[model samples]
Target chain A: MTDPRLTPLAASLPDTVPFVGPETQQRRMGREFTARLGANESVFGPSPRAIEAMQAAARDVWMYGDPEAHELRHAVAAHHGIAPEHIRVGEGIDGLLGLLVRLTVAQGDWVVTSEGGYPTFDYHVTGFGGRIEQVPYESDRVDTKGLIERAGWTGAKLVYIANPDNPMGGLQGARAIHEMIEALPQGALLVLDEAYAEFAPEAERPEIDPTDERVIRLRSFSKAHGLAGARVGYAIGPAPLIAAFDRVRNHFGLGRISQAGAHAALADRDHLAHVVSQVAAARARIAAIAHDNGLAPLPSSTNFVAIDCGGDGAFARRVMTGLGARGVFVRMPGVAPLDRCIRVTAGREADLDTFAAALPEALEEARAAP
Target chain B: MTDPRLTPLAASLPDTVPFVGPETQQRRMGREFTARLGANESVFGPSPRAIEAMQAAARDVWMYGDPEAHELRHAVAAHHGIAPEHIRVGEGIDGLLGLLVRLTVAQGDWVVTSEGGYPTFDYHVTGFGGRIEQVPYESDRVDTKGLIERAGWTGAKLVYIANPDNPMGGLQGARAIHEMIEALPQGALLVLDEAYAEFAPEAERPEIDPTDERVIRLRSFSKAHGLAGARVGYAIGPAPLIAAFDRVRNHFGLGRISQAGAHAALADRDHLAHVVSQVAAARARIAAIAHDNGLAPLPSSTNFVAIDCGGDGAFARRVMTGLGARGVFVRMPGVAPLDRCIRVTAGREADLDTFAAALPEALEEARAAP
Candidate 1:
């Protein structure tokens, strides 16, 4: 019997995870993947300095992490030239997103996002009983204008827009983003998820005014820093919104190792630049491979690329299955039209080679299978 | 202008944090404490080998941690002589408590906990909009009988009782806890937070079967393992309830370094036993000092001791202040009656010496403050 205490909302909601990890997929499949191209994780690895800092912090895990997150905040502030009050660090963008939802979302409160944006955000909204209004991605980018119009239509309390968006590696430049920001209804907080911002070209990143209270931006060490396994991400926003997080956040959620690793990673700009360069090269290679196969690879500004297979979702599903049977683990979007493509993460040359070797055979089998 | 889509429950709840961290206190004091004793953290520290394992994990922070958490679960299962399905590891006791509440407590759903119990659980209940009915402590031990009675009266969904309770380190024997569990109202789930279990005497720990579906127990690496800073904890329960966590948990919330450190720490029973012995000695020392100062030290099974300082909450506050002024960070309970005592965490010899030296003067000043 279900426990009597669960609220009606929690009780009514089905227990479901947003995205199953590739590890779970592997376990279910009863074998490991030949290439880990799913989940958009960096396989090139983290900075040497970051690794050193994390290793050093391993033994001192007994002491609670500094609750204020002072040193790391100072480092982030110095790096971004913002006061510590403007930055809020959390477990990851996912954890921060949950808190952001908690800060503003209530039963029946409207949350607007692209139909196929991050699923974790969707999970948090429903978990908190928020109503969601979706706008479809226009040509692989978050349809900002459509989003704004819908926000007005739904009178949403919060709106989420990920630049250099996920599922498909497409970006909305700073000018367009800034113009769209001006259109956000007052008191409607914009949650800018910049998990992939590091990969976006310099001109694409909007000039963020730290003192602006209308929006809160989230970034993570998980991607560019190669610290995805470390679970460290921070929200940058106006002092008030950032401070409001203190009122409800898991104060000691960040570990000593995570905090120390993030601080060290932030200081090691040399490694970050190198990883960014490597990722750029990998993206180019991935796009070229798609072109050679007569598939259309969307322009990517992030770690993953969405390749349009020029067919319906069922066809793409067959291709995904074919690839999976060959021990290549890849994913696809859940919505219509977007589901016409398969999404693959940028990995090392060896991983890509595995994907290349597996794709053709899988596609043929998918095409031939009943 | 806020998003109109928020659920009514999320909208009505104010953003609030359950505990003000020691680091925040340090920031407010404008100095770091020489003897960090607040927050009930173990200053004794984690094992040497566990540190090595964490250091090794730092090198691969770029990759996502194993979502299955296989290695860590296997270690815990073997260590406890239970099936792997019986375990669910999380960020810490605090994080797990929040999850448990989410799984059970709902908006206006009745829940029961001791008045002087851990505030984090209450925070979770409030966050989830559960209607809480607090049963006052009976001699600083969670009033188990009262808690059960309240559940029967209010049709509580969950009943939380921490054996080897926090703030006050008193404990009840296993038979008492077992009897309390048997008397629970129909459909009520019992959450036995054993965060301090390792420190409890062998006779005090309940021998309830791990496979029991009626109760879920919590354990952590924070105290006995000296990995409070690492943020690792686990819940033990029947397979079905444990499996349900998979539906809602952040799949990759636990970091790579922490998982590795916890695994290694669990394997090293020698280190754990050593920590237990040291804690016992420290508790005794703290109790003796309380006696010497003409104060009463309540019986303790956990790492900290709650000392009844002569006078009311205000005088206790003064003593806490004087001690803080002298760079010793101790804490007190938030509610009345309980607030009349000061809580001090067990620490290293140097730390205890500092606290012992400072206490007499702090008490004198507190007595004369009016």
Candidate 2:
């Protein structure tokens, strides 16, 4: 029998998704992998203070989270030198992205993202029935001009770009992105997803004037903060726009313990800096391993490195599959030239050594695969 | 300059929301209230085991939560005797509600709900641009036939009913809801929100099979489970429907500590039973208090009591304000009729005494206020 409650629009949408969790794949494969490098999650862990806060609050999980996310928002606002009115904390950037899509895009509305940018953002745009238009990455960087020109051409309402961009681990200077933000078509919003911002060179963070409308920068605790498991992300924008989240968000939806943990995490700026250093160190180590294996590791400003596989997408797929078969988890880009690379997250020393050992063997196996 | 990014449909939608959180009110009031009984959160809290599990796992916040929520889903499926594929976990019922709206409703899509059922559900539908068509409750029970008729009349793609419903705390037996579901419009989906199900009589729960594609059931940790701060909720339905969540949901969105806590909470059936019993006792005590105060408390199956103020919405508003002013943070219904009653959540004895002491005075003050 057909589902009777689905609207025509829901019915019309396809059931395909962008990424499947490694857990699902594990279930399918009936075994867990050894080196977990696939999803770009930090294996280094969160601050002791954040962890302690969550643990302490866990017993009190009986209370609903502070709906206003009061203390966390204040801490975040104070940290950024902006008023709390300028911030809205969410489940994650992914959650915020979905909410932003719902708030700003309607069915048949045009939303733009780079062809090989974050797939989750594109998923949100399409999920809300927004028609997606894309700009391919140029020289391993997201072409902000091309995105703006397309936005103007399609009259798109939203555009997504990850600074310290993902997969390729490229960077765009603050001045250029800020200039692009200013040039964005009137009425359109710039969604700067800075999931990897903590790792971005200091100069790469676009100097966002708090009063600037038409742009909302998304930040996450998942990367350098090492709280990926907490699912904390916030969007920074003009007050009126930030307030719109209240109009549509899951208000009492935050986890109380998670909120306390995030608040403490944000307060302990020292922890964040330490994690940042660890990430930089991991990146350097990962680059060395890729070079030793004769694969070219792209310059990265993020936690993960994408190693050019020296062949086509199919060859890269073979390499990824070979590693998986040997119990190492890694991911690859979705499209051509980009797909000729495999994305590996920075992990602990043991994990890195596993990846190091697996690479040459996997590459040889892929080269020999029929 | 305009927000060139927001869609025409988004531009048409208002930025104002129906619910302004109590925290925001607290901030506006410039002081914290002594008793926070406004939001119907369980103040007693979750099981110690659940708390312990979450706290213990807190330090591992660097690893992303299992995107599939594998362990948690399996636990829920086992608890309900359903296949793991039949359950979909999300941020919260509010978050699940948002996803369900997107899954079923589109702009101009017909959606049916009780006039003042759950405002959050309606909020989600409206956010997704669905046109809400409300039917009045009969004798405070959601007029099942009225909803079915409205669904058929408007060809509503989705219909929502909360058993042991919010605001009113009214209930309908499985047989009644089953019949309604049977006669529901072809292809019209039934959304049974059982947030308060643990407090509900077992007999009142619908015996519908989990694999039934025509319906979806939602349960929350925010209620009796007392993990409201954790933001864990699940939607149970057929494999195809559950699979649909993967098509759009943020895979790694659920937080690590939350996932661990919810899994533990689900496993501790004894704790759940204890909570259910305590809530029942509290509900009885709350009802008795309403009677002692010369108000008619609606018989409830949930954790809160709705005490009829023997007047109109304005009188109930006074009672709420009186309670608020005197440090008893009770709330009243939003719309008319139901607004004739003040809603009070079950709290500790001291909190109840505070309510008892504050009521008449608040009432007197309301009577004297211009």
Candidate 3:
């Protein structure tokens, strides 16, 4: 019998994964890393209360999670000072992005983003057969102006921007973002991903109208809340667009434990304040380590610091490899220019101590490489 | 500014949720379900070892789960006597079904299923713009022959069948399933969802070639393993097709706790066997209850028994509503002939005591209704 026929779009796509986890790297290397600082995960972990809630939720694993994710949605809505109708929760921002792409992007539709912005967003756009128009980052930040101009030219349906951007950890001020939204072409929607909003200063996060049809804000419990492994994220937008997600989403996608954990995490404001302070200290430590190693540390409004290796992409790659060999796990930007820097997440004192101890040797090894 | 423009297909689709979860109903009613037998979940709950594993994993929630889901995938592969490459773990069977539909069904593509088969599968198919061709059930079981015939005539790309069927609890034995697979039209793929496989006799499950390109077998941790709230499901198929999922699936979709729990659950064979025996006893008790109430319980190979109320679709719906009002949550088939029955899940002794106490009154109320 003939093999099953894939859709033309599916057939044309190549098999790939957006981000490889540290676990896979550890398995390949046959040992665990001494410092697990990769992927911008909050090593400080979730609140003790959140852990207790998840543990309690473990006993009720027999029932499917509430399909509507009612309690968690309301909690998130309250936290954002928005009505519950303005919020939609999904497996994560990644899952929600996929659904949004499906809803708005038809084959050959145009979408716009920065050259080395979140690869997962680009992956979703391409998966839905949308053509991407990438504009290079201006300075270390995402070029909002470039993005808006490209969207205008391409007549793109969707435009994506991540505040306090990944890899470089650079922020665009609230006013810059408001201008970007105002400049959006007719029928074009801005996808403002604020995954690290909790880590940024309040003024750096735009205060958008909840009913604004031009933009949708994405947030994650992964970073500041320390619930990355829980797979909880939410979107806030116009009621109609938020409600539209119900039509195409896996209604029962969220796990009961995840919902309980996230809800508890949101309720613990002291823990969030503690995490933000701890992350600030860690980021400072990372920056100091970069300076001591004779490297340049970029300004960061997020949990990670990007350290310029004082060399090109290949030299930086060798430094990253050397760090990995020294049992410190870290990542770098994929595209050039940004690739000159190795992105390091803020970790606990012990974890960063491992990174600090390894930096000099890794830099020496990279400098000595042919 | 104009609102975002949805793709033509998305704009044409209606906003709907596949199933109204019991939690949603409970919230609407402003009370908790007394029996909780509606969704066919294993009230016996997951293995204690699995619960411990999950609770332990919760502490590490700061880290994203292994994108490859290595340990759990390998465990699942070993259980089925197949290579790890043949398995693809997803959020749940529902999530996997959506991905499968995306892979095979393009706009206007044809898919075939029983008229009242799992509605979530149909939701996924239609969400991707595929046209559905439905064949009526034969007796209470999914009509495999009729599905094959329909596929041949419509040149359908995908055909879905659930063994030990939902809503009716009917089964097609191994030989019949093998015949159905053999008769699949060229280029047509069979999506065999065996979510309740652990509850069925071994002889009833088909033994197929792992490399068979014609079919993809789905299994869930939800039903007999009692991890429905954990949202773990897997697909076993040809290596190429299984690997293809990596291209489109959320790479880090599975949660760390879920992976750990499923891995622990798979290792505890005694727990699985105990749950199976418990489900069997509960099903028998439900059948006995139906007989005492002068209703006929269909022969079941699943965790639930479908009892004929000796009435039409509307009457069965009324009976379900009556059960809901009486604090016993149960469901019924959505199509005719089969709709004459209300499906009740196997539950603990106390839970079923509530069901037994409520059934006669519910039936009387349904019969008394206009």
Highest lDDT model number: 3
TM-score of each: 0.94, 0.95, 0.99
Per-residue lDDT of candidate 3, residues A1-370 (tens digit): 2134878888877778898888888998999998989899999999999999999999999899999999999988988888998999998888889999989999999999999889999999989999999999888789889999999999999999988788789999999999998889998999998899899998667899989999999999899999999999999999888888887999989999999999999999999999999999999999999999889999999999999999999999999999999999999999988899999999999999999999999999999988
- Put the candidates in DockQ order, highest first: 3, 2, 1
Backbone clash tally (model 3): 0
lDDT of 2 by residue, B183-269 (tens): 988878899999988888897788888887788999999888888888899999877777777656777778888899899888888
How far does residue B308 in candidate 3 sit from its true spot (Å)?
A: 0.5
Docking model 3 quality class: medium
Q: Report the lDDT tens digits of candidate 1 across residue range B241-268.
A: 7766765567788988888889988989
Clashes of each: 32, 18, 0
Give the range where candidate 3 chain B is weakest over 10 consecutive residues by summed lDDT: B1-10
After superposition, the stretches of candidate 1 with alpha carbons farther than 4 Å from their true spots are A1-5, A29-31, A321-327, B1-16, B210-213
When just chain B is superposed on the true chain B, each candidate scores a TM-score of 0.97, 0.97, 0.98
> lDDT of candidate 3 vs native?
0.91
